[model samples]
Target: MKFSIERGALLRAVARAQSVVERRNTIPILANVLIEAEGDEVHFRATDLDIEVVDKAPAKVERAGATTVNAVTFHEIVRKLPDGALVNLTDDGASGRLSVEAGRSHFALATLPRQDFPVMANAEYSANFAAPAPVLRRLFDKSKFAISTEETRYYLNGVYMHVAEANSGRVLRCVATDGHRLARIDAGLPDGAETMPGVIVPRKAVNELRKLLEDDDMEIAVSVSETKIRFATPEITLTSKVIDGTFPDYTRVIPTNNQKRLEVDASDFAKAVDRVATVSSERSRAVKLQLDEDRLILSVNAPDAGNAEEELVVAYSDEKLEIGFNAKYLLEIASQVDRENAVFLFNSSGDPTLMREGSDDSAVYVVMPMRV
Candidate 1:
């Protein structure tokens, strides 16, 4: 295969594909990216058995052929090349090496037969829909932080994406939880997505997919089946197997009766939590929140380390309430509230607390309290 592509275009395409290739692979071919040159474009494909990503870039093709080469090595070489230099990739099919040439730099990388690369079979999608990039970005970005890392409860290791009824109407939702905290975000459902099957998008896939949603105006075509899901842009496509498990019904965990409301500046609250948490022991970084008519005091006490206390004026009118929570959880949830004020509803010190941005119910968070 032989082709010439601009360095910027080559690097971007290869970087996207190579991220799916793990550093260590049991199968040699799995560690390489399949490079195919044809017509006026070149395709870079990489997979790690469970997930696959393919990216295409415009190129001047000299020969129509395909080969596989170490994804990491090729990416590094292209990354170091001069910004506007044109890159030439050539493989003779018998030399067992791929030649990369750019300006004054040249290198030969060992190649594997393209026929050995495993490509996932095409799936029959039950639902296909188009969503604005910003909408999809908000859904995943807000909830992914709570995705579980525990492997035993595999179902909890990803964001649960599905269609559900919200107060306004039917909405697309993404929910993630790690037992201690949960994030629930909703967006208006797109047309033709009413029958979309709920899928647990694995954590790795969720992170990689975020990279494609940076362009707010871009439209993403999403396809989903019972066992697999695919997200496609104009030049890239990502496919992955859905987690084989059922997500727990999270409605019961979200408090609907809590009436104690405390509104505070989200940024200030997060910074206060961070300062107080500095004196907390690693094992139990708990912060106690004391609320009065319109005052809130955050305090942390660690026998071995020290004690910290900070007071902030807030909007609270209910009966005085004192609650304890994991400082880290509070900080994370607070940061998600991009708006100026974060509204918190509390039932008691022992029950889970609910938080939202100002008056927005579309994006809500639930955090379990810890005994201080």
Candidate 2:
């Protein structure tokens, strides 16, 4: 196999594919990327058993063929090469090695047989739809922060994407929770997505899909089946197996009739929480919010450390209420509010609190309270 590609283009393609390759692999071929050179493009395919990514880049083909090489080594070599330099790759197929050559640098990396690379099988999708990059980006970006890192509850370790009935009509939604906090975001459903089945997109796949959504003008083609989910563009495709377990019904946790209301500047609130949290106990990092009339005071008290407090003039007309929450959770929830004001609804100090951006119901967040 032989092909010549520009350094910048080659690096971009290889970087995308290699990110899917696991650093530690029991199977030798699973650590390598399969490179296939065709008429005018070269394809780089890499997988870590659960997720697969294929990136295509335009290249000048000297001979159309395929080979496999260590993904990390190839990516490192390409990244260190001089920008704009022409990179040539070649493999005789029998030597069990792939040659990478740039200006004056030459390296031969041990190769695995291309046939040994495990390519994910093609899935029969139950729903296929196209969504603008920005729309999909908002859905995932807003909710991914709440994805559970706990491995035992595998179902909670990803963002749940599905179609649901909304006040305006049917909408596409993404929900993620780690028990302590939850994020739910909704977007207008795309045509032909009505039949889409809800799928829990694993955290790793959600991260890989972020690269494809960077281009605001790109339209992402999404395909979903019972067991797998795929996202594709003109030059790249990402596929992953959906989590086997069912996600908890997040709706039951979202507060419904919280009467007390408090509206505060999102930036100011986050800064206050962060500052007070510095003096909080490292183990708990609890911050308390004391609210009455139109005043909100945030305080953190740690016997081992010192205590700190900050007051913010907010818009709260309800009766007095004091609630304690994890400082880290409050910061995360506040950051998701794009608008100037973050509205917080509270039923009591013991119940979960709901927050939203200004008056927008499209994106809502729920945080479980903690004892100070």
Candidate 3:
């Protein structure tokens, strides 16, 4: 395989594909990025059994052929090359090596046979739809923070994406939880997505998809099946196996009749939580929030370390309330509130609390309280 591609274009494509390649791979070919050059384009494909990402870049093809090379090494070489220098990649098949040449630097990397790369079989999608990049980004970005990292409960290790009924109408939703906190975000359902089956998009795929949705105005084509999901842009396609498990019915976990209300500046609240958390013990970073009328005081007390306290004037009218929560969880949920005020609803110090950005119900967060 031989092709010449601009440094910027080649780097971008290889970077995207390489990110999906795991650093430690039991399979030799799994560590390689498959490079296929044909016509006027070159394809960089990488996979780790469960997930596959293919990136296409325009290139001047000297000979149409395909080969595989270590993704990490190829990416590092291209990243260090002089900016704007044309990169030439060539493989003669017999040498079992791939040659990378730039203006004044050249390196040859061992090549793996392209035939050994495992490609996921094509899936018949039950639902296919298009959504604005911003819409998809918001859905995943708001909820991904709550995705569980526990491998035992694999179902909870990803964002649960599905169609559901909202107050306004049917909407596309993404919900994630790690038992202590939960995030549910809703977006207007796009056409042809009404019958979409709910799927748990693994945390890795959610993260990879975020990179593709960075362009706010770009439209993304999404395809969903029972076992696989695909998000495609004009230049890249990301495919992953859906977590084959059922997500818990999260509705019961969301507080419904929490009456005590408190509204505070989201940024200020997050900062206070972060500051107080510094003095907390590493094992349990607990922060106590004491609310009375329109005043809110945040304090952290760790016997081993020192203590911290901060007070901020907030909007609260209900009876006085005192609650304790994990400092990390508070900071994460508070950061999701982009608006000036974060509206929090509380039932009691023992029950789950709900929070949202101003009066927006489209994105709601539930955080379970902790004992200080």
Candidate 4:
């Protein structure tokens, strides 16, 4: 294989692919980036078995062929090369070594057989739909905070995507929960998505998908099957197996009858939660909320560390009430409220509380209370 690619173009493609390659691997080929050159394009493929990323870029191909090289060493060498240098890569197919040349610099990397790379089998997707990048961004951005990292409940470690009924009619919904808190978001359903199966996209897949959705208006094609899911754009396609487990019934955890309502500036509330939580113990991050008439005070008391309290003028007319919740959970949920006011609806001190964007029912959240 022999090809010459522009420095900028090569960097962009290799950087994306190499990130999927882990630093250490028991299997030698897993640490290499598979480079295939044909026509005027070169494709770079890297995988860690579970995830694979392939990126293509325009290159001047002298001879069309394929080879694999250490991903980290190649990336580091190319990164240190002088800017605007044309990079030439050549491999004789028998030597099992790839030579990289740029200006007066040259380095040889051991090659691995391309036949050893593992590829995920294709699946018959039952549903295929398209969504604008911004819509998908909001869905993941708002809900990712609630994704659970607890390994035992692997189903909760990703955002659940499916169809559900909303106020008007059918809507696409994404929900995530970490047991203590839950985030539920709804977007207008795309055409032909009514039969979409509920899929728990693993956490890693969600992060990789976010990178592809950076273009605000780019339309992404989504395909889902029983065991695997694929998301594709004009330049790239990503496929992964879905978590083979049932997500707990998140709807039951959502509170519907919390009567006491308190509305406060979201930014101020988040800042107050941030400041007060600093004094709380790490294990039990409990913060007490004291409310009366039109005032709300947030306080945290840690046995080891000093206590902290913050007062803010709020829009509350309910009788006096006190409730406790994890300071970290409160801060995270409050930060999600984009606008000025975050409305909190509380029941008794021990039950789960509800929160939403002021009076907007489009987005709803629930947080289980903690004992201070």
Residue 69 in model 3: lDDT: 94
- Model 3 agreement with the true structure over 1-372: per-residue lDDT tens digits: 789999999999999999999999789999999999999999999999999999999999999999999999999999999999999999999999899999879899999899998989999999999999999999999999999999899999999999999999999999999999999999999998998999999999999999999998899999999999999999999999999999999999998999999999999999989998998658457899999989999999988889999999999998889999988899999999889999999999999999999999999999999986
Q: Give the per-residue lDDT of model 4 (tens digit) for 240-297.
A: 7788889888888888788999999999999988889887559457889999999998
Off by over 4 Å in 4: 281-283
Model 1 lDDT per residue over 1-372, tens place: 889999999999999999999898789999999998999999999999889999999999999999999999999999889999999999999999999999889899999999999999999999999999999999999999999989999999999999999999999999999999999999999998999999999999998999899998899999999999999999999999999999999999999999999999999999999999998668458899999999999999998889999999999999988899988889889989979999999999999999999999999999999997
lDDT of 2 by residue, 45-67 (tens): 99999999999999999899998
Task: For candidate 1, list the clashing residue pairs, or say none.
Answer: none
Worst 10 residues of 3 by lDDT: 278-287
Candidate 3 lands at a TM-score of: 0.98
Which regions of candidate 3 fall more than 4 Å away from where they truly are?
none
How many clashes (backbone N, Cα, C below 3 Å) per candidate? 0, 0, 0, 0
TM-score for candidate 2, please give it: 0.99
Report residue 358 deviation for candidate 1 (angstroms): 1.0
TM-score of each: 0.99, 0.99, 0.98, 0.96
Candidate 2 at 364: error in angstroms? 0.6
